[model samples]
Structures are given as C-alpha cells and as structure tokens.
Target: MKLRRRLGIEWTGVALAASLIVCGLIYWNSLSGFDNLLYDRLSEYDRPEAPDDVLIVAIDEDSLATFGQWPWSRSRHAALLNQLADAEPKAIAFDILLSEPGDSEEDMAMANAAAQTDNLLFPLHFVFPGTNGAAFDIKEPIASLKQAAAAIGHVNLLFDRDGVVRRTSLCFKDTANGTSNDEIVWPHLMEQVYRQINGESSAIFRRLGDCQQPLLMPYANRGDFAQVSYAAVANGEIPRAFLKDKTILVGATAQGLGDQHPVPLGDGGTMAGVEIMANLLNDITADRFVMPVSTTMQIALSLIPTWILLIGFWRWRPRTTIFVSVGLVIFILSASAILLSLQIWFAPGAALVGLALVYPVWGWRRLQATSDFMDGELKNYRTETPDIPVLQVPLGPVDLVTEQAEELAHAIKHVRDLRRFITDALTNLPDPMFITDLDGKVKFVNKLAQSGVEDGVQDLALDDMLERFVAPEGLEDVKDYLAIDQELREHDYVDFTSVKDEIFAMRRARILSDEGELRGHIHYLADITEVANAAQEREEVLQLLSHDMRSPQAAILALLDGQDATDENKRIESHARRTLALADNFVGLARIKSSEFSGEEILLSDLVIEANDSLWPLAKQRGIKSTVEDYTEGAFIIGEPSSLYRSFANLIDNAIKYSPDDSDIEIVLRSIDLDKQAFVSVTITDQGNGIAEDMLDQLFERFASNDDDSHGTVKGTGLGLNFVSAVMARHGGSIRAENVREGGARFTVLLPLAPEPEELV
Candidate 1:
C-alpha cells in the first residue's frame, strides 16, 4: 500500500508536468512573446553577411533635397532607369510602387526606358480584405509599364504577433479579385530579380511547399548594405563602372516618406522597407532561411527535460534534483542557441516552463507522500507492539515529519536492544552451538563453539569450521551425516570424536522465518565423552567373555567327542556346547547394541536355505528331516549379513533341537504384506511338544526360555532367541514365537523387502 502511494504521487507529477508543456504548445501564440524575445537575442550573433553584389539606392534626405519633393514624377524615375541602363547593372528592382496610371507621356517615357533596360523588375502590392468581398486585391503597375518590365513581383513582409518583421513570404497566392475560379501566384520582388540574374528560381523559393508559406529570415547587420543617393545615380554623379554587374534596389529611405517598419534587430527601432527587401533578397540568394520544427517535434522536445527530472525524483535527493533542475534550464537555452546557429529555430520557452513548473510541484508531492506513509507506519508499529515502550519525542512544537523521524529512531534503538539480548542468550549456552545460513557459511557461534574454533570464525564455511574441531577420522562421517536432508535422515544426532578426543553428539535443526521460509540451520553439539567410553568398556568385557570362555568350552567338547559312546561323555559334551552357544549369543547381543547397523541386500530364500543346511547334521542325528518350502519366488532384504545369518541359524537350530526323533521340521519362506508395507516372512515349525501356554509370551525374552518337556534330554540357552530378536529389530523387522495348534513351536520373522536396483538408483 505504501509503495503504491509513492508511485501514485510520482506518476501524478509526470502527468501534471507533461500536461503543462502540451497545453503551452497547443496555445503557442499566446505564449510566443518570450520565445520571440529569445529568438531576437539569439539571432543577433548569427546574422548573415551582407550581399556584396546588391546595392540600395536610397531616396534619403540628401536625395530629396537634390531631387525636390517625395512624389517624384514618372519622368524622373524614367531618367533614373535610363541612367542605370547606361551603367548596364546586372538586374535592377524598382521597389517603389507604380500601380496607378500617372501622366500618359511621363508614364510612357518611363515604360519606354524600362523596356530598353535589361533584366528590369517592377513591384506589386496586395491590399487584404479588398474592396467588395474579395479575399485580397492585387495591385500592379499600369499595363504599359508592366508590359515593359522583365517581371513584376509582390513586395510583402510577414509580421509576427509583436508587429515585428522577422519573416518573409517568397510568393503570394489569391484568386483574382477573390472571385475567379483559378488562382494566381506572385513571387517576391527580390525573387523575380534573382531569377532574372541567375536564370533559375532561388533555392529558398523552391523549397516552399505551396509558395504561400512564410519562412523565418535571418537579418544582416543594420545599414550593412551599401547605399547610394538615388539623385546622384540618376544625375550621373557616380561612376558608371561602380554600378556595372550589380543588382540594384531603388526605394525611399527618407523619414518623411512613411516607409519605415519595426524589425527584430535587438534594438527599439525600425528598418526602411527597401532595406528590409534587401535583407530578404540576400537571404534568398544565400539560402539562409531559418526553418521551424514541426508541432509534434516541439511537444516531444518540450517533454524530454521535464520527464528526465520527473523520473530522477524517485532516486535522487532533493538537493541533487535542484541542481539538475538548474542544469535543465541551462540545457534548454543552450539547445535553442545551438539550433539557431544551425539555421533552425527551436523555441525554448515551453520546455523551460515545464522544467520550472515540475521541480517544486513534484518536490512537494513526494515529500507529502513520504510523510504520510511514514506517519501511518509509525502509528501501526506503536499500536501492534504496545509493550515495547516508545521513547518520548522532543518536547516542542515540531513538524509532523520530524516527530515521525524521532519515533522511527526510537523504534530502531529498541530493535537493537532486543537483538543484543538474543545475542547474549546464545553466547552463554551450555553446549557448543553455531548457526549457518543456506550457503553453509557459519554466521554465529556460542562461546563453547568459539572455544573449539579460532577467533573470527564467523562467515567460515561449515566444512572449514568442522576441520578445526573434529578429528580427521571422524570428518567424513560427520560430513556424510550432515549431507542428508534434515527431515529425511534416519537419526536426529550423530556422534563424532573431536580433535581433543572428546566425544560430541551433533544435532541440527532448521531455522524458519515467521512466514515459514527456511532461512538456515542451527547446530548443537552435546558432549557425550563419558557415556561413549562406558559403552566401549562394556563391549571390551563382552569380547573377553566370548573369546576366553568359548576356547576352554570348545576344548572340553573336543575331548568328549572322542569318547562319545558313553553316557557321561555325551553329557559332558552337551554341557560344553551349551556354554559355547551362550557365550556366542551374549557377545553378539553386545556387538549389535554398540555398533551402527550397516546393511546390504541379501536374498532371503538363499539365506534361509543356507541356515537350514548348516543345521542339517543335528537334524539328521535326531532323525528329524527339515523340509524347505519356497513360497517366495525370490526376495531380498537389506540387513547386516553376519547378524541376519546368526539370527536365522538360531531359529532353525532351535526347531531341530526340540523336534522328536525322525520328526520333520518345516522351514517356509514367503512374501506377505503386514499393514501396508511389503515384507518377507520366514517360519520354522517343529514336530514336537508345543510351547506351554504360559511360556509363549516370554519365548524371545532374555533368560526366559521354554523347557523341553517332550524330549527332556538337554536344556536350551535363552540368549539365542533374545539375540535373534535384537537383530530383527535392528533390521526394521519383528519376530514372534507361538505354538501351532497341531504340535511343536513355530517361530516367524518378518523383514522389510529391499527395493530393486533401478528403484534405488
């Protein structure tokens, strides 16, 4: 929720900033004043060089003083044309309007002179919203003069909203008297003159889409064009050689003529109409018009810097954003100036406004969102863990954000205290304890664990940590035990001798997060040196009893066997063998108890047959034949080979011992399912006196044997059945003894079946 709010604020800022720029572009005319101001300033430095071949013949104050009043007659203009013709100027543009018919002789005289002049041009003018309902009216010189001139063109200037002449139209298009079906187009007066001199349309005029659009014109410095008095040129006071091959413009520059207009020269002044025309002609010949960017491009560019700062708000600090905002302003202006130099105008006002508007507004929104989020979180924190006392903030009138910050600091300090408490408790644990993360790198160690490791043990791999503490012989055992999945391991703890020869039982448990994510593991090592040593000593004593007692008993059986026909000798031999069997049973029990159970796959049918065959001699002596019944086709079980062999031998031998002479003993191997688990069962039944009802319960118990009432010859050792029971339990199996209804005792053992090799893999 908090993240959403912050993103919401950020996107809102983006929309607001983008909307401002787009709207500014949409209503650009109302916002173009500053753009024009900037253009005027930027363009001054990139003014074009004045055209050297073009000269202005100004009818200025000095020219008026010499030529009399402003309405100079056509006869006078005729003389001027005749004199310029004598000079053989390359092209002459008569900028002064001569639309109306004047005195016939005077006009005819001027027309005749213009007809003689080579490449002579006359001016045409337009009156917009013309007489009647026409869109515009075109004014041209009388027919005689127009027929005489090489070409006649319109003299029109394009004014911006500020009434400054910054642009020029290369041509004008209108329907005749706004009533004719066909449209007529008039080229600019300078364009006509340039065509006469160069024999082709100017590149600037050619690039226009419809010859009606106005293009931004770059100006040369004021008064940069060479000028001469019209009276001197007409009176032949100037050298004719100086005028040769020059394109000349003849117009009024006198202050009294009312031909002056405002222009963008970075000065609060106006330029003469003739000089403005000279600048326009220079631009066409040089092809130096400034092209404006399209509207789509304008809005796209305007949004760039604003979005840059808007996205930066998420990652940059307020101070850095402020500096970037200023940089964006400079960047916008610099871009405009650079584009201006390339003869392209990209006004920077809309972009500057976007950058300026978005910075502070976004700053406010971001701060507000953050403050609200923090306030909500702090309130919830205080409410949820009320027992954790929050420290009081500074006792003064403080802003909400500052107060929230103070509360957050207090909460952080309280968490740190709780962490310290947990650390202390773990440090003082009685047993060696350590923690490791998912990567098996140790992260924490109790004091007892640290004592066994070097300083700076944290962050060491679990294997490296074990190397420092565990004995070399026990390292692989511990590693293999740890490698098993914790939940699936057979035993919860494994014992290993440390480097100091102290036995420790290591146990591990998972560390889970509150969300039940498995974060790491905690290992505890409990010292069991004394317990392990006592068990070892017991096993050694059992080893002494088994070996030392069995040797003399076997010697007695060997001596008795040589004299076996006598009653006393047979009795001695029976006693000696019983003692040997007792010793073996006791030792086997001790070994199985002390050692770990390591198992291999053994075929149950084959092992049962082998056990029966080994006891066949005894069965033959008693005239008891044991028949093997194989119900199981072939079955295997995982168990210790020695123990399982001994266990099966004990059960079969007991069956043969109790059976009557020549009575058959049955050994059956079969597969059965107990509960839902698969197992192989071995049953040994003897044809003899059945177990007494009271002795059946204690048949497999240690020292609890059933007396052989039917045979009454030899007493059985009770240790065998107990040892068999122990081995069955170790192999995840069970043994049961019961009397069959018809006769003798029946012993049954069930062991879990081993999986196939493919299943194991």
Candidate 2:
C-alpha cells in the first residue's frame, strides 16, 4: 500500500487501539457486561472438592414449612442456639442483623441461652453513608443479646456497579449524617468472627479500589458447602455428630426471607447471602484467595487481538486474517478460562471486541483512502482524463439498505482506477512528501518517507522526520511550518539545506474549504540542489571576474588627472570605482559566511571613531559634514572589533552615498533604559528620502531594497544592512530602521550594557 493509504490505516488502527485500551482500563475498574459474562461463564467450569469446615444453617422453605411462619419468634432462635450449643460447636455466627428487641420474655430467653457458652457471634448493621436517611447509629443485637454475644461485627456487603456482590469490605466507618464522624473504622463480621475464633488481633488488609477487598470466595458451586435448616436445629431433629466442631452460619434462605445475590458461579441464579459468607469463611479456613490479574497486564493483553487482526489483514489474505484472528481469540478465551480456574482472571471479552472490530474499521479506513485518492486523481486529470466513467449499478430489489450498499460499491468502482493510479504515482515519486492535519499529526507520507523504517522507527511525528532530514539551522523554520506559523506563512517560499547538504525549496499553502475555513496544510518539497549550486557557481565567477577587472580599472582611474579630467572621464572613473566597491562587498560576503567571531569587551566609541575617520574622506569630497554628538565614555559593548568596525563603516558609507553634496551626516550615541535593563543606543540618520513604507519590513534581508535598479550604488548589493543585522543577532543586540519624520532615514542600534571589571569583582 502507498503511505497515504497506510496513514489512513494507521490512524484507524491507532484510534481503535486507543479505544480498546481505554475500555480495558474501564473494565479493570468496573467490569463491562461482556467481561462480567465471561467471568460468569468461567465460573461455570469450576469443579472443586466440597469443603468440610463450615456449615450454613439456612432458614430455607422447608424450615419455614416446619417453623410455623416467617420472622419466627426470638424464643425459637434461642431454642436453635441452645440445641447447637449442646453439640459443643466451635462457634455460631448470625448473618441476620437482630437490631430491635423482640418480646421481653422472648429476648430474655434468647439472651439466656446465648450467654451459656460464650462462643456466640451476631451481626451489626450500620446505615449506608451518603444515603438520604443515613443514620449514625450502629444497630446491634438487642441489649440482652449483645451482652450474650462474644463479638459483634458489621454485616455490610459491598456490591459492584451491576449489583453483583463481588467484594467484601474489611473495615467501615460510622457516619452521623452523610459524612464520616471522627474517621472511625469498624471491622467486617467475617473478619471479626475469624479473629475471635483464632484469638488474634487485626491482620493487614489490602483494599480493592476504594473500600472493599476482593473476596476470593472458595465457592465453586452453590452446593459446595454443607447446609442444614434452621427448623431442624430449632426442633433438634438433626444429629449432633454432623454439627460437632463445625463453625455454623445462620440466616434465612426461604424465598423472599433471605438476601439472594447473583454470583459468578450461580449462572444468573441467586444464592443466599448467608451461604455466600459461609463460602468466604470456608476460603479463610483453607487459606485460599484468588489473585486478580494486574490492570497493566490486562490492558497490554487486550491489544493482542487488535495487533493480530490488523497485522494479519495488512500482511495476508482475508481468509487467512480471519482464520488467524478467530483462532487467536479462541486461544485467548480458553487460556483466560484456565487462568480463572487457577484463581487468576483476565478479560477475554475485551480481546474479543478488539479482534471483532479490526476488519470493519480497516474497511472503513480503505473507503476514506479511496475517496481521497480519487479526489487527487481528478485534480491531475481535469485536463487529461476529465470524463470519469461511472458504473451503473442495476436496480435490484427495492430494499433501501441493500441498494445503498450496491450504490456504494458502484461508486467505488468508478474511482477504482483513480486509487490505483495515485497509489502508483506516490510509489514512484522520487522525493518524499507529507501532509499534516492542524494538530501537526502526519496524515500522509510518500513511499520513501522512511525506507529503513522496518528496522525500528515508527509513529514518528512530522517534526521528528524533519529533524532527522534537515540541518539544525533549518529545523526551526521546519517547526514553524509545522506549527502553521503566521510569520513563516507570510513568506511565499522557503529555501533550506538538508543535513545531507541538499537544497530544497519548500512551498507551504493552507488547504481550505470553499467556505474559507482551515482544514490543514499541504507542504510540497521540490529539490533544487543542482539549480542552487549552479547559481552559486555563477555568483563566484562574477565575484572573481569583478576582482580581476577592478585592479586594471583602478590603474586606469588612478592614471586620470584629478583637476583637469574631462566630465566623461570622471563618470567612467566613477563607474569603475563602483565596480571595485561591488567586488569588495562580495569579498566581505565570502568572509562573513565562513568565519566564527569571538567577542571581547570594547568601547563602542572607538569603533565609531574608526568608522567616522574611514568615511571622512568620502564625506569631504561630497562636502557633507559627518558630525558626532558629545556623549559619556560609558558606552561599552562586547563584540568582534573588526565586524563592529565594518558594520559601522557600512552605515556611514550609506549615509554619505544617499545624501546630496553639502548635506549634514550625523551619528549619535546615548544610553537608554528598558525593563530595568541598561543598553547603549546608537542612532544613524541620513538626510535622504526616508525609507519607503514597503521596504521598512524587509530592509535587513539580503538583496532586499527599495531601489529597483542599480542607481547610485553598484548593482545595489543590498547585502550591507543584512550583514549589519547578522552582526547584531550574533551579539544579542537589535537594530531597526524607521522613516524619520524630518525627511531622513533613522536607524537605531541597541546593545546591552556590560558591567565594568571593578563591578564584576
């Protein structure tokens, strides 16, 4: 595939990958319905040997059948406890929260029986925090029953988002209103009962998310634990041998009387909440708790299906891609189920979603690429192949949905040639071209974008590619273009050197809709190394020839009579002198481009004086007075002495050349303060026609000038002010030219003040 098409595919693949990762992270927090279903299915395959330590004394329907009615009298519970106590059981835990007092005599009967063995445990229910009627009170067994109980722990269960009781809280807080009061914490019932049974204090707990700890309930199936009935115990109809040395959990399981929670193993079926706790306690006995797969690992593994399918679709045939994708998905599910059985869980559904989406998303991406390719093809063929052949899809059944697909296919066929042609064009192009969106993401690249990308590099930003290819000095302009920089956009064209020393002219234009809104930009890079090098060679030839001719021309000029020379002779001498000046300017250009100058602190006045002395003779011939203002001696700056003198001399020469004979030429030096920074300012103004409004902006650009023809100077070398600008840039100074109001052009130069040696010390 061509890179433009590849870019579309890459974008679609990345977007789909990002969405898959985000969803996997979300599932890690609160599992999706599909992920939850997978977990449920995996639970169905669990087959564990039954445990023997814990018993569930359920208040099932049979107990209700035998025990008269629901909410049996407290005396009846007392009778059950009394009978269980006689069996010398290790402990008895109540899942039901017996908060309010029953009949006095009945509560007394239950209390009296519970106080007998001191191995009784009951539940305490606290109001849910942030609820409308949130209560601060902790509901414990009635006073007499509380005294009889060995320990009381909260029976609050933590449910997941979909109302599945997946975890259990190790600790909870009592809140008066909707907020926690005093940050107090209370342990959960199972934990507290276990501590009491083992004679231990608090053990360390790790929380799952905010409050709950993951419950690795050793529960394999609903009937995994031994269950008896409340009525059987209450009536003493069961053998004590079955109950001896067992920890008993008591709660209602008769239809609506008990809390029924949907568990992973229950197959959409409900298990009694008390039986759930029984399994938890059984797991505690066996020291078996499930370890969840890490979220990072889950996220990474979730991308597997996308990677497999996307790579396969791009590299292989459709049938092979589907076969590989489907096979990988099956392998993932099977492995995940096995992991779940081993008490390690992974989200198989997340992988399934990623795999299932690759083909449709890839197809959609192809449709877009086809459309773009066709648009470009029409542009190329508007003068060559304007009449595009449109296929006429036959009118089939009157189903709009089916007809839409047929119409789409017919339309795509119309552009099928365009897609192939553009694909070939981009593939054959000698140079790499890239297109980017407003956000600087590369939307397209040619076949040669990165020929060596197979080894390592991928997902390179446009700037990164430029940095790799372009010279460091040119990288800034490349970045500015990438940023849609307004200043760079003002330039119609840019010429820069690549890191390989190749020359290229880059033309950037905004891609806009007919409505004149920005869509993005197209950057076309045209290599012009040979053309630019040939131009440079021509310039060097002119400079050398000019240098060679200047000596003979000067000899001829020097041989002229200064006082008795004819007007024609004077004019010839003048033209020859201009030629010599142009040659000298070329010499300066070659020198400046190749040399690096080091700076030392020097008085600006010295360079100024040297410049004035050098130009005084030229000024005298024109009868112009080159005046300097009286200034303090503190105008010190740091710069290369030669470059500084040359820069100032160029300014004075311009002033002398532009002004008429007998004109006053002036240079002023003073101190200025800005933003608490001290700077020395130099002002040079020529009493000539002030700078043109248009020329002021680009006055410092090489070969840029207001003078169209070479009028006074030799070919208007316009390299003068540009050299001055480069000098200032190197020295961390600034220069600006403005049209003076008094019929002259004013140039101001500012250099930051340097502290004296004494001050530095």
For every candidate, C-alpha RMSD to the true structure in Å:
8.7, 18.0
Among all candidates shown, the one with the greatest TM-score: 1
What lDDT does the true structure give each of the candidates? Answer: 0.85, 0.72
TM-score of each: 0.62, 0.47
Over 441-464, each residue of candidate 1 has an lDDT whose tens digit, in order, gives 999999999994555788999999
Q: Write the per-residue lDDT of candidate 2 for residues 1-761, one digit (tens) a residue.
A: 35465665666666666566547555666446777666766666664555686888999988888877778888888888889999988888988778987789998998999998678898888764435554545777788888888988887776666777665666675443235445556767777767777886333343235335555454657787788888777777889988998888898787777588877665567778887787666555555556567667877777766776665665788788767877987898888888877777787666676666666776666656655555554445434543544444575785644555555555567568667766667656787566667776667666665554454223456677677668999988766655566544656667789877988887776778755788876667778899998878866776666567677778877877465768888778777876766566556656666556678898898788788899898889879898877474657887888777878888888777777678887899988888998888989987876666767778888878544432232222277888788888777889988877777777898887777678774
lDDT of 2 at 312: 67
Count of residue pairs whose backbone atoms collide, per candidate: 1, 0
Best candidate (score: lDDT): 1
